[model samples]
Structure formats: structure tokens, C-alpha cells
Target: MPGGRLTHGDRRRIAAWLAEGLGYAEIGRRLGRPTSTISREVARNGTTGDYAADHAQRVSGDRARRRRPARPAEPPTAEQPTEVVRGFVDRFATLLAATGLPRMTSRVFVCLLTADAGGLTAADLVRRLRVSPASVSKSIGYLEAMEVVVRRPDPGGRRERYVVDDAAWLRAWQADTGAHARIAAAARRGVEIFGAGTTAGTRLGAMGEFFTWLSEQMSGSSLTASAVYDALTVLAALVHAGRPLTLGALAGALDWPEDRVTAALDAIRRQPAIADPLALRTVGPRTYTLTTRSDRLSQAQREALHR
Candidate 1:
């Protein structure tokens, strides 16, 4: 069994084996390493699904470099500005790490998050974090996998820059729901294999339902731009009318395309954050109304709608 650290060749072989759908056990056997080592290596670099051999090699090199002795420190400059930036970075990165992000990954993300240019190159990251290039590379790999950062070609054709997009939070939200969807699917499989009447199956079935419900809730809340605008339009019309209106009446009041109004109503009904704030109600068959009761919604619901 080869020891020390995995060579670039080893990472390439691991990536190849992963692509062939081999489990950690089989891949470890072929590489003559323990399954746990293969598992941890893959997890650290990128999970099996997104692992890239070249990136893994670069990350490993970075880690090794970081463990070595550092050169003598240069004289400090701009003490106040540096201290302010350091304070902000530390506070923001600490908060992000508290939210389940790896510490180094959180620092890299916070660094990019706070950058005025909305992006940073590898060198920029290393300089800002005062860490080895490998650390930056590895952190970038994780952020890229999570879609927390994007890589763009540098204008000078030198190194690439990592960017945090305006929609990074939206993408992260969708990714989180996607994870729940996968959990639901896995639990459903358990239900099939264990029989619904069995205790194990019962637990699996409940777990599947919970994840599926959570996924739908997350998905339902993310209305498209058009949908949000239309929903607000319908809501405004209902507020103006100040009374329950049948679907036909609501359509006429808006003077909008029937399909547009219908779709908007559906969107509002599915999103409780919006619906609760508006005091939206279905009074009778195909009828809708907005309540005037100020107390209908809690403070939290109102805040959520604004967001």
C-alpha cells in the first residue's frame, strides 16, 4: 500500500474509478488504500459526484505547502485599514462557519463576499486570507461545488477570478432543497425494500414525507420575477376591492390576461410567506379575498414578505 500522500496520478485514478460508479470500498481496493482514506480524500476535495482530479492535486499541494515553515514577516503597513478589514473578515467568517460551512471555506466566502469588485483571483485570496495558495484553491473548489462562487477568465488572460453572484443566495437555497429531495428519494427506496407495514418501513416513509414536504415548501416559496409581480398585482386589486370576489370577477377587475391572473393567484396561494402577509383567503368556490384584519399576520410573516 502506497503511503505518505496521494500522488497526482493516484487522484487521476481515483477520479476515473469514481466515474465508473465504483463505491469507496472497491476504489480503495484498487488503490491499495483504506476505504476511509478514499472517502475522506474525496469528501475534502469534492464529493464523488463533482470531484476533479486536477483540482484535487492542486488542493493537496496547497495543504502540504501550508504545513511548512513561513518566511520572516515583512513590515506591516496601513495598520488601521488592515485591522478594520481583519475584524470584519473574522466576524463574518465566524458567523458563516457557525452555519455549517467549513472554517477555511467560510473565510474564503466571506473574503469574496466583502470584496468591492465582487470577485477575487487566487493570488488575491491568498493575500487577503494570509494563507497558502493551496488553501485558497481547496476552499475555492468547495465553494464552486456548492455554487457559492463562480470562476471567470481573467481579462488579462492570467489567472481566473472567483466571483460571488447576486443570485448566490438563491442558488444556495435551491441546492439545499435539492439535497432534501435526494433524501426523500433515498427514504422512499427504504420503504420499498422494507415493506410499508414494517417498523423500519414506517419510519422511512415518514422521513421521506417530511423531506418531500420540506422540498416543496422551499420550491413553492421561490416564485419567478414575473410571478412575484403578477401576484402583487392581483393582491393589490383584491385590496382595492375590499371584498371577496369570485375568480371571474377578480379576472375582470385586473383586466389582465385570464391565464396570467390565474397563474398569479396559484403562486400566491402556494407561497405562505406572501399569502400570510397579504391576508389572502379563499372564501367560496373559486373566490378570493384579502383581509383587513391587521392582526391576521404575525410580525415574522410580515418581515418575510418584504424580504
Candidate 2:
């Protein structure tokens, strides 16, 4: 009964509890239901001061009657069991919700992530999640704003489908790192406001430094993580060879395509001077070497070494 759908009797008790001015948690404890369940019920029905249990019960019954009948259970497959996938979606959505994503938004994201087509229409999400179309639409907008989801025209219909592809994570990372940059700026402002000599200012200064370092590390390049990794690998190869290598030679040595090697080198060249300790130099046509920058060391470290 604790986890089952709320009955008309439950609604009546909730109305009575609201009349008594009891909080959601207290009502939930008395009813053996979760606080969220109690809160959602009241919020859906009406406000605390004007809840009508009978009306709420009638509306809920009508909505339930309008819903499509449940489909027959499919047999479990060796590759992907239906029950297993359902459990995974639920658990994953919960984990995402814990990370500050709204509960319904997390559910919608998990649904899209697990969809076989890698995309889903709002109708599909509503049916699968058993949520209203409005909820699905709102979640989609939130995910799109974060660049974690993209909408494309559905091939089969006029309705658009939402997709979360490989590049979605890269975009999400960039968006999140952008927030870190803003936070670093705010911390710097705090340091200035509090005065650098004060305790608060010192803490803010350290926080600003940490966020700045973190933001730089994650947002050094607009390239995807894999591209950055490939660039680093190319740099490592040059370091190990201790000499300039032709594109062909590097590609052969790394067992990668020549184009991939070239792309990696190009990525390294595009990095800002402050973002990378190593620089790519061309000593001969189509040949490249990695050189450590003299300014790689901090100013204080350079001064210490000179002394």
C-alpha cells in the first residue's frame, strides 16, 4: 500500500491532514507514503487551503480511464531483458536526479539515452515515462538549454524528435565548464569585496584559484575529449622520439591514419599558449616536433631557479 497508487480514501485523509495544517512529512509518516507522493498529490489536486478530495479523486479517475491499456508483457531476451532495462532506467534516473537534475528531466534524459533509435518524440517519452506531454516538453527544453539534447525533424512525421548523441556529452562538458568560469569570476569579486588581507578574502582567493585552474583544465580546447586525448598522445610520441617526425612516420609509428595524426597536431597548434606547456613546431615540410615552453614554469618558480 505504501508504494501503490493513492486511493480515494488516501486523498480524503490527505485533505483532512491539510485541514489540520500538518506538514507533508508528517502526513506522509501517518499515511505510510513518501513525502514527495503526498506533496505531489496535494499540488496536483489544489493548494493546502482549498484542496477538495472528492474532486481530485474524480479527476484522477477520469485521467486513468483515458490512459491507454497496458500492453502485454514481453518475454525476457538474452541480450536485453525488458525488466532489467526498466530497472536500470529507474535507477539511473534516480542517480541523475541526485546530481541536481530535476526528477522529471532526469527521467526524460534516461529515456532518450536508452531508446533504441537514439531519439524519441515527445509522445514516445510521455507514453514511456507515463507523464504528461507538458512535463516532457519542459524537460526537453531544459536539456536542450544545457546542450545535452538536440532536436531533429522526425523522418516519419511532422513531429520533431529529441536526440542525445556522442557529441552531446562534449557540449554538456563545455556548458558545465562555462559555469565554472562564471563561478571563478564571482569568487574573484568576493575577494575584492572582502579585502585580500581578511580571512574571508583569503578563502575566496583560494576558491577562485581552484575554480580557475579547473575551468582551464576542462575548457582549454573546444575540441571533444577524444580529440584532446589524441593530441596528447601525439605530443607523447614526439617526446619519446626526441626528434622531429614526418606525418607519415608518426602515423605509421602510432598505427593511426595519417589524417588522424595531422588532425591531432593541428589540435595542439590551436591550443592557447597559457593552456598548454608544450608547443608544436614545424622544422621541415610535413614534419613536426614538440618543444616545452620556457614560460611553462610559474613566475615564482622561474625566479627561484634564477636565484
Best by lDDT: 2
Clashes of 2: 0
Candidate achieving the largest TM-score: 2
For model 1 the local lDDT of residue 18 reads: 95
Task: Tell how far residue 284 is off in model 1, in angstroms.
Answer: 16
Candidate 2 lDDT tens digits, 1-307: 4668888898999999899999999999998999999998889888899999999999888888789676787775322337667688789999999999999999889988987654888988877777899999999999999888889899998999888988998888888788988998999999899987789987887788678767877766677788888888888899899999999999999999999998888777765332267678899999988776543554567789889
User: Which residue pairs come into collision in candidate 1?
Assistant: 62-134
- TM-score for predicted model 2 compared with the true structure: 0.51
Ten contiguous residues minimizing lDDT sum, candidate 1: 74-83
Residue 160 C-alpha lDDT in model 1:
92
- In candidate 2, stretches whose alpha carbon ends up further than 4 angstroms from where it belongs are 1-81, 221-307
Clash totals in order: 1, 0
